[model samples]
Target: MGLLTERGELEAERLTPAGERILRAASTLFYERGIRTVGVDAIADAAEVTKKTLYDRFGSKDRLIAAYLEQRNRVWHAFLDDQLAALAPQTPADVILALFAALTDWMAESRRGCGFINASVELAAPDHPAMPVIVAQKQWMRSEFMAQAALGGFADVQELADRLLLLHEGALVCFRVAAMEYAPEVAHRAAADLLAGWPRD
Candidate 1:
């Protein structure tokens, strides 16, 4: 967890409807326009709250972005967990393929790219408060991939993880730039071929 700027009084549960409104507006605006591009005043306008109230609730723009990333992280992790969970009781190879299917479904939705990857580029500051949260998300994702490989009985779990990480990140890059969702299919096929040749323990 990144250290927030100030020990702000941002208790999410205690947030008023007005505060929720601010969060909702921030989520939309920040996702559409990168975090740095959307100013505090713009968020205030979108949320229909005065800048004073926004500051009173969240303290700083950086804190607000951190809150947004945290919120987004929760939602995305739930989706990934649910999809990965469905692959249980199958061979790890099958589970890996199922994971790619879930990724394909995720890419079919419009305007959804890997949020952490996008945020990293936009923030550009190494010590930016958002970096820790993004780093955690990536670390967790890779660990989950590795664990799945291990469960599948693969002896070389680390190598499989490395290859899948490349495939997964490359797929996201393709989706972001070319608006191509086919990377999932291509990557899935390549992964399937790799697994086919690997000796099962």
Candidate 2:
């Protein structure tokens, strides 16, 4: 976790008020603009801090990018956890299928596109600092699907989780790249169809 391992030390390196501003500013610019395009000068200006202050906090652009993904993953996971917790009393199908609707809402608000996906594309090198954060976010999603599928009593939990995760990934890709409109709804319907095809015990 060299880069991500730094994450384990977040509490020790908790941001100052100015550091918070730097992170928020970077998050918006990096996500809205491509990661490579948004320079540290731009982020420092937006955050209303000196370039030296930015460097003091983040060390370098790579570290800042890693922090952004970690921040994004944190917020995204909290949102998902809240959604699933609220769905606790509902049918497992309802809980599992809420992903599409969630994506619809998220995409509607985050029109710039998937933050992690954007990072992946912008930072193509496999060893890029932000790569691990992106990988962890995706793996967490698939793992969450597996947990929900098992609780849902799906006949094939792993298979079902895999298909559902594919639908989730496909919907995001469609929203960003392929079919922009009607993507989430189409994925939702397809998820329902998959649910129908795979009966639970």
- Most accurate candidate by lDDT: 2
For model 1, what is the C-alpha lDDT against the true structure? 0.75
Local distance difference test, each candidate: 0.75, 0.79
Spell out the clash pairs found in candidate 1.
Answer: none
Per-residue lDDT of candidate 1, residues 54-168 (tens digit): 9998888887787788777777655666776665535657767776777787777636577778888898898888788778766665666687788778878888778887887
Residue clash pairs of candidate 2: 1-5
RMSD from true fold, candidate 2: 4.9
Backbone clashes (count) for model 1: 0
Best by TM-score: 2
Q: Over all chains combined, what TM-score does candidate 1 have?
A: 0.84
Expressed as tens digits, the lDDT of each residue in 1-201 for candidate 2 is 110111221222489999999999999999888899999999999999999999999899999999998888777655666665655536667766776667777778788668998889889899988898888777766776777677778887888888888998888888888747678888889998998788777
What shift in Å separates residue 90 of candidate 1 from its native position after superposition?
Answer: 2.1
Candidate 1 — worst ten consecutive residues by lDDT sum? 1-10
Backbone clashes for every candidate come to: 0, 1
Off by over 4 Å in 1: 1-14, 84-89, 110-112
